[model samples]
Target: MRLPRFLLAGVLLAGSVLLLTELFAYRASGAVAFSIFTSVWLTLSIVNAGLGVFSAGYRPSEEAAALLPVFGLPAALAGVAWWAWPDGPTLPSPRLFWFLLAGLALWAAIALLAALLIPHATRETALRTAVAIFLPLWLALQVVNLLVGVLIENYSVAEELLILALNFVLTAAMPLAASRLAQRG
Candidate 1:
């Protein structure tokens, strides 16, 4: 696919995921955490969509080049957001910069793993490989978070597990759905 078309797919995927996150957040928390969760989800969805498009059938050098935006865009945006709205509720403390940095590292790792694991095959096959590789890694991370009380909040263990499962399904589905649409187009 062309760069512009790939980017359009990324934007559409980001928008859809953002919309879903917003709806879920509103229903679950009665208010959207626009500055934090929504922003992070938007960044993840956009980067993941880009990864889905460019991960397969590319030379190593080209894949490295493609990874620039996948990793850089979110970090750049987060820095800009921190600069623009330093007093925003989501990032009231400077320490939240650490969270942004950690998120960047995690995204880079996930993208690398997906790119390495997905074979150069049909789009559907590549997407399936990605889902297979990513879901387990994602679940493992969630389990670590649960054990470490990273974002436990006030929820019971069962509720947190349910939420994690839902998130895993939705997150895994997004790139697959985007790839399907891109293939059809």
Candidate 2:
């Protein structure tokens, strides 16, 4: 079961966001910020990956697809770790990995559900039509997420920039790439 390229982008975006979250943690709310951003990063990954799957038109393998819901696992685990040991190093646990797997399953389900609800509508004209609908919503969500993250982290300029960069890279750039590939294909 080969993963799609855009899906890889989602994963990369998640990792980058996680790193950026860590970088800004001390400036924000100290150790607690790390845990909060960790969960946010995981949620973003799941959402982005689900979007990628739909845009790519590739179906996930049965076994792999079943594990989508667990994609949110990382965030859950991060929160748990923070709760369990407020002063300890945040170590990645097997439970989190399992949850991540569940997130993947949940993601797959969302993608599938979106497909059923929205229909393809990928024709050049339809895509152009939908762009009007999707772009603004996408940008809005990204910006809102950015703002919320910044606020949660206590208004760090660097964190805001990180969110902006992440939004551009994952939400904006990747979708444009997908649109181009879709046109070519």
Candidate 3:
């Protein structure tokens, strides 16, 4: 897929995920922290899916070219979120910024490695491989973030696990679904 199409898919999917979560989960729970967490998760998922889809059938160098926007979209969104977040006495804006930066850096490194390792694979294969590699790295980061108190408590362990599972499914499935549709057209 082309870069613009990849980016458009990422944004649309991210927006849809955010809207659905806000409507179904956030509204009922009424928890700001949970909403933020859900948004971040969905944004990152969009990045991962976009990276996989756009990098398929490309060499490492070409994949590298696609990496910036794939990573940048979520990072930019996160930055916006931080900027727009309500400033209260308890709000640690600087810390949140650094935390987000760190997460983005880690994700970029992992994604680059995955892309290079799976270079020039078939669309479905490349996306599946990327998703397999990314899911663990993402889950590990989430665990670390939770343990380090970067992610505030808003849901139970069971709920978090469910969300994680759903994330994995969506992240893996979306690219494959898009690729199939692209093939038929």
- Tens digit of per-residue lDDT, candidate 3, span 21-120: 3323323322343355446545554555555566544455655566667656744654454345323113234433333333343333333333434546
| TM-score on alpha carbons, each prediction | 0.39, 0.33, 0.32
Per-candidate Cα lDDT values, in order, are 0.45, 0.45, 0.46
Candidate order by TM-score, decreasing, is: 1, 2, 3
- Indicate the residue-level lDDT of 96 in model 3: 35
Pairing residues by index, what is the TM-score of model 2?
0.33
Question: What lDDT would candidate 3 get against the real structure?
Answer: 0.46
Candidate 3 minimal-lDDT segment of 10 residues: 21-30
lDDT string for model 1 (55-128, tens) is: 64455566557556654454454445445434332323432233333333333344434443444555555555
Task: Return whichever of 1 and 2 wins on TM-score.
Answer: 1
lDDT of 2 by residue, 59-106 (tens): 555324633533444445445544654553343543223223323332
Tell me how candidate 2 scores on lDDT: 0.45
